[model samples]
Target chain A: MKGNEVLAEAAMRAGCRFFFGYPITPQTELAAYMAKKLPTIGGTFLQAESEIAAINMVYGAAAAGARVMTSSSSPGVSLKGEGVSYMAGADCPGVIVNVQRGGPGLGGIQPSQSDYFQATRALGHGDFYMPVFAPSTVQEMADLIYDAFDLADEYRTPTMILADGMIGQMMEPVLLPPERDLSTLPAKPWATSGSRMERKHNVINSLYLSPNKLEDTNYERFERYEQIKEKHQRQELMSCDDAQIVVVAFGAASRIARTAVRDARKKGIKAGLLRPITLWPFPTKAIDELCDGGASSFLSVELNMGQMVQDVRLAVNGRASVDFYGRTGGVLPTPEEVLQAIEKVAAGEPVVQSAEPGAVGSLLPHPKHRKSSYERGE
Target chain B: MADYNHELLCVLSGFGGQGLLFAGKIMANCGLIDGRQVSWMPSYGPEMRGGTANCSVSLSDDAIGTPFITKPTALIAMNQPSVEKFAASVQPGGAIVIDTTLAMNGAEGVELADGVEVAAFKATEIAEAEGLKGLANIICLGKLWSLTNFCEREVADAAITKCVPPKRRHLLEPNLRAFQLGIDA
Candidate 1:
C-alpha cells in the first residue's frame, strides 16, 4: 500500500467518519482515497473550496463530536494554521496530516522536512502545541494515524501526522489495522449536541472575554500538555549501549540514519540511532538517558535546514557536543553521505553546523553548470 | 531458487509514460510474495512532467532502511537520458540492462566502475515485433531477472498476476509472452 492511501484506510478503521480536505500534491491521493471510500462506508467526505475552508470544516465536524481529519502539503498547511489554532483554543479533537514538501513560500513540490519548526513549534499563532507523530515507513503511517485520532480525542486537542513526501508516495506491504467498533468508542460528553430540554445546552467556543478566564484556559491546556510530555514521549533506540556518537533523526531522515548507523558499526565506530516517533513531546527523556550513559556526541540528521537540531541541543543541554548535518529543498542525504559525516564526527572534525548558501549549492550541484563527481572522474 | 539473504537494490528509469514505476511495483510485489521485506518509491512531482521518471525498489531478508537508492545493484534503463543519468551510479559487480533500441550507444561512453556487467537488448524492437508495443519495460525486467535471478520464475509470474489490474487482464498473457521473448533473446 502507498503511505497516503494507508493513512486513509487506517483513519477509516479508527472510526473517522468525516474528512475535509483541499487537494495538494503528494497528499492529494489521501484525499482522493477518502473521497472514494468514505461515502460507501456511510461517512462524509467534503472537498472544500480552499485549505482554510477545509480546516474550518474539520473544526466544525470535530466540535460535533465526530472523528474528523484534514490533510494538506506545506503551503496549504500554512493556510489552515488559523483553523488549527481555532480548534486548539476551542478544545476540539481532530487529526491533521501534513505531508510536507519544500517550502518558505510556494516552494517546489518535493519531499522535505522543512516544516519541522512549523509543525512542532509554531503551527499557528498560539500559546498551544499539537502532538506531532512522524512515521518513517508505510506501516508506521498506518499505525500512527490510527493512534492519532484516539490521542486527539483522549486529550481534546488536534494531533498531527508530520510526514514527508517520501513516505507519502512510497509503497510497501503493510498489515492493515483491524477496524474499530464505533459503538465502543469513547463518548464525547462535552459535544454540543442538542440539550433535548433535559439539561443545560453545551457550548463550544474559544472566545473567553475575561482576561483571567483566558489565562485559566491556557493554564489548563498546558497542564494537559505536561501530562502528554511525561507519558506519550515515544522513541526507538538502536545500538545505543556504550555508544560514543548518537545520531538523532526522525521520519524519512531517520531511515537513512539507521542504515548509516549500521554501516558505522560495521566499520568499528560506536554509533547509534535515536528516532523520535513523536515530534511535539520531543523525546527529551531518551536523550537525557543516553547522555547519562556517557554518550559523548550527538549528530542530528534531517532533510531540512537544521530545525530539529535545536531541540536535540536543548535536550543535550551542554552534556555533549551536538552537530547538525542536512540537505534542504527536498534533497535527501545518502547513507554514504551520512556515514561520512559520522566518520568526521568520530575523527574529532567539526561537521558543518548549518545549511549555508555555499554548502547547499555544493551538496547537489546543477548538472548543467557543474560536473558531478562521477562526471568529474572523482 | 536464488538466495534471498542479501539485499537487491534496483533502479528502473525511463520517460514518464514508459511504465517504469509499474515495473518497480511488480518487482516489489514479487518480494512480498516471497515474504521478504520490500519497498518501492517513485520520483514524483514536477520533474515527472515530460521529464525523466524513475523508481527505486529494495528487497532483502532484513529490514529495509530508506527506499531511495543512490547506488543500485541493478538498473534497467529504457532511454538515452536514463542511461546517461544512471549508468555511472551502478555499484561494482552490479548488472545493468539497457534497451539498445532506444539508448543506441548503450553505456559505451560512460565510465562505469570496475566489475560492472552490462547487458544490451533491443527490447522495444522485440516487443513491437511481437505486437507488445508498450511492454519494453517488462521485457527489460525479464532480462534483469535472467541476469540477477533475484527471484524464482514462478514468483515473477505470480507477481505480474497480482499487479495487473482486473480490468486489464487481457494484457497479462501478452506481458508474459514479451517477458519470455526477452529471456530467450
Candidate 2:
C-alpha cells in the first residue's frame, strides 16, 4: 500500500472511526484514498466545506473521544490552526496530519521543510503545545500516524504527523503492522458516548472565563506537556559519535542531511547526521551530546532559512559555535550544497551554499544493491 | 528479490501522454505488493498541461517522510523544462537519466557542478522507432536500472505488468519487450 493508504490503515488500527479533511495539493490522494476505504471499513469520511470545517469536524469527533484525524498541506493547515488551538484548549486527543507543502502563504505545492516552526511552536492562538512528529520516510508516516493517536490519547492533546510534500508524495517499501497487534488497543475513558448513569453530560470546550479557572486548566495542561517532553523527547542520531562535523535536520531535510554526510565523508571529512524524528520538544539532549569535540563545529540545515538553526545554536550554547545553511521559497537544499556548507563549517568559512548541481548517478539499482553508502561504509 | 522493503525514489517527467504518473504507480505497487512503505505523488496544478508533469515515487525499508523531492537522488527527465527545473536539484552523486531525444539542449538548465552523474539516452526516439510510442517511460526505467542498480530488474517488469489496465494487458508483452530493448539498446 501507499504511505497514505498505510496512514488510513494505521488510523483504523488505532480505532479512528472518523476522518474529515479538504483536498489540497500533495495530500488530496490521502483524502481520496480514505474516502473510498473508510466507508467500506465502517468509518466516517467527509470532504468538508473547507479546511476550517474539516478541522472543526475533527474537533467535534475528537471531543466524543473518537479516534479522529484530518490532513492538509501548508495553506490548508494554516486555516485549520484555529481548530487545532480549540482542540488543544479542550485537551482533545486527535491526530492532525500536515502533509506539508512549501509556503508563507499559497506557496507552490512542492515538498519543503518551511513549516517546522509552525508545527513545533503550535500554529494557533494563545499559548499551547502540540507534539509534532516529522517522518523521513513512508514507513514512519504510517506507523507514526498510529503512534500519534496513542500519544494524543496519553496526553489528552492534539498531535501532528508533520510530513513534508516529499513523504506524502514518495513511494517506499513499508510493512503493514500485523493485524493481531493492531486490534489490542484500550478503550478511551473520556469519549462523550451518550453518557451513562455513572457519568454526567461531558463538555469539551476551550473557554474558561474565570482567570483562576483558566489558569488551573492551563497549568494542568502544562504539567501534561512537561511530562510528554520528559518521556517522549525522541530523536535518532546517525553516525554522530567520533565525527568531526554534524548536520542537523528533520523531515525530508534529514534525508538529504544524511546523504550529505556520506558525500562529505567521501571527501575525507568525518561528518555525521542527526535527524530529529520529533520536531517539538526539540532533541537538545542528543544534539548537545555531540559537543564532546566529536565535531569541532556543527552545521544546522533546514528547508527554511534558519528556524531550527536557532535551536541547534542553543543546544551548542557556544561550546562550539554553530553554522546555519538553508534554502527558501519552496526550494530544497541538495546534499552537494549541504556538503559545501559542511566544508565551510569544517574550515571556519562563511556560508555559501546553493541548490545547484551538475550531474547525478544512475536511477535504477542492482538486485544486490545496498540501501545507502553510509550503511555499506563505502 | 531485492528485499522488497528497500526504499526506491524515482521521478518521471515529460509531456502529458508520456505515462509518467502511471509508470510511477507501477513502481509504487512493486513495493506495495511486498508490503513495503510506499507513496506516489504526481505533480499537477498548471504543470499538468503542456508544461512539465512529474511523479515522485519512494519505496523504503522504513516509513518515508515527504514524498516530494527538493533534491531527488535519481530522476528521469524527458523534457527541456523538466530537466532544467530538476537538474540542479539533484542530490550530489545522485543519478539522473535524461531522454536525450526530448531533452535536446543538454544541461541548458543545469549549472556546471561536480558529483551529479548524468547519462543521456535516445529513449523517446528509440521507443518510437521501435513502434512503441508509449514505452518511453519503460525505456527510461530500463536506463534507470542500468545506471543505479537500485531495484531488481524483475520487480520493474512485474510492477509494469501489474499496473497495465486489464483490457490493455494484451500489450503487456510489447511493454516488456520495450523495457528489454531499452535496457540493452
Candidate 3:
C-alpha cells in the first residue's frame, strides 16, 4: 500500500467518518483517497475552498463529536495553523496530518523534516501542546494514524501525524488493521448533539470572556500535556547498550540513519540509532539512559537546517557533545552521506554543520553520488 | 552472477509517460507475493510532469531499511538519458537490461562498472513486432529477471496477474506475452 492511501484507509478503520482537506502535494493522495472512499462508506469527505476553511471544517466536525481528520503539506499546514490552535483551545479532538515538504515558504515539493520545531514547539500561536507522531514507514503510517484519532479523543486535543513526502509517496506491503465497530467506540458525552429537551445545552467554544477563566482553561490543558509527557513518550533504541556514538534521528532520516549505523557497526565503529516516534515528548529519558550508559557523543541527523538538534541538545543537557548533520531545500542525505558524517564524528573531526543561505557553498561538501547539474541537463 | 536471495536493489528509469513505475510496482508485488520484505518508491513531483521518471524497488529476506536506492544492484534503462544517468551506478557483478530501441547507440557510450553484465535488447521493437504495444517496460523486466532470477517465473506471473487492475485486465495476456518474449530473447 502507498503510505497516503494507507493513512486514509486506516483513518476510516478507526471510525474517522469525516474528512475536510484541501489538495496539496505529497499529501494530495491522502485527501484524494478520502474523497473516493469516504462517500462509499457512509462518511463525509469535503474539499474546502482553502486549507484554512478545511481545518475550520475539521474543527466543526470534531466539536460535533465525529472522528474527523484533515491533511496537507507545509504551506497548506501553515494556513491550517489557526484552526489547529482553535481546536486545541476548544478541546476538540481531531487528527491533522502534515505530509511535510520543503519549506520556509513554498520551498519545494520534496521530502523534508524542517517542520520539526513547527510541529513540536509552535504548530500555531498558542499556549498549548499537541501530540505529534512521526512515522518512518508505510506500516507506521497506518498504525500511527489509527492511533492518532484515539489519542486525540483521549486527550481532547488535536493530534498530528508529522510525516515527510517520502513516507507519503512510498509503497510498502502492509497488514491493515481490521475495521472498528462504530457502536463499540467510546461515546463522547460532551458532544453538542442536541439536548433532546432533557438537559442543559452543551456548548463548545474557545473564547472564555473572563481572563481568569481562560487562564484556568490553559492550565487544565497543560495538566493533560504533562500527563502525556510522562506516560506517552515513545522511542526506538537500536544497539545503544554498547554504542560509543549514538545517532539520534526520526522519520525518514531515521531510516537512513539506521542503515548508516549498521554500516558503522560493520566497520567496528560502535554506533547506534535512537528514533523518537513521538516528537513532542522528545524522549528525554531515552537519551539520558544512553548518556549514562557510557555513550560518548550524539549526532542529530535531519532533512532540515538543524531544527531538532536543539531538542536533542536539551535532552543531552551538556552530558555529551551533540553534533548536527542535515540537508535542506528538499534534498535528501543518503545513507552513504550519513555514514560519512558518522565516520567523521567517530574520528573527532568536525562534520559539516547547517548552513545559512549564500554560505551553503562553503559549508557543504559535494556529495559524490549526486548528479551534477550539467549531467542532469538541468 | 548476482545472488537472487540477497538484497536486490533495482532501479527502473525512463520518460514519465513510460511504464517504469508500473514495472517497479510489479517487481515489488512479486516480492510481496513471495513473502519477502519489499519497498517501492518513485521520483515524484515535477519528474512526473513529462520529465525523466524513475522508481526504486528493494527486495530482501530481512527488514528493508531505506526505500531510496542510490546504488542499485540491478537496473533497467529504457532511454538514452536513463542509460547515461544510471548505467554506471549499478553495483559491480550486478546486471543491467537496456532497451536498445530507445537508447542512443545501444549503450555503447555508457561506461559500466567492472564485472557488470549487460543485456541489451530492442524491447520496444520486439513489443511492437509481437503486437504488444507499450510493453517495453515489462519486456525489460522479463530480461532482467532472466539474468538475475530475482524471483521465480511463477512468482513473476502471479505478480503480474495481481498488479493488473480490473479495468486493464484485457492487457494482461499481451503483458504476459511481452514477458515471455524477453525471456526467449
lDDT of each: 0.91, 0.78, 0.90
Local lDDT at A227 for model 3: 93
Interface RMSD of each: 0.8, 4.0, 0.9
Shift of residue A46 alpha carbon in model 2, Å: 0.3
- Residue A206 C-alpha lDDT in model 1: 88
Worst 10 residues of 2 chain A by lDDT: A358-367
Sort order, DockQ high to low = 3, 1, 2
**TM-scores of all candidate predictions against the true structure:** 0.94, 0.80, 0.95
Evaluated on chain B only, what are the TM-scores of all the candidate structures, in order? 0.95, 0.89, 0.97
How many residue pairs collide in each prediction? 0, 55, 0
Provide per-model DockQ scores. Answer: 0.76, 0.30, 0.80
Off by over 4 Å in 1: A353-378, B1-5
**Model 1: how far residue B86 lies from native, Å:** 0.4
lDDT for each residue of candidate 2 in A1-378, tens digit (9 for 90 to 100): 455666777777677779999989877778888888889877899999999999999999988878899988899999999999999999998899888777788988877778888888859998799888988877787778878988998889999998877667655666665442435655666677777788877777899999999999999999998888788888888777788788888887887788778878889888888888887777878877788745678788887768887788877888877777777767776666788778877887776544343223222222234268787778
Arrange candidates, best lDDT first: 1, 3, 2
Per-residue lDDT for B112-147 in model 3, tens only? 888899999899998898888899899999999989
lDDT by residue for model 1 (A20-125), tens: 9999888988999999999999999999999999999999999999999999999999999999999999999999999999988989788899999989998888
lDDT of 1: 0.91
lDDT of 1 by residue, B1-185 (tens): 22334778999998888889999999999899999999999988665787889999999988888898888888999999999999999888888999999899999999997887889979999988888999999999999888888898999999999989999999999988877876887
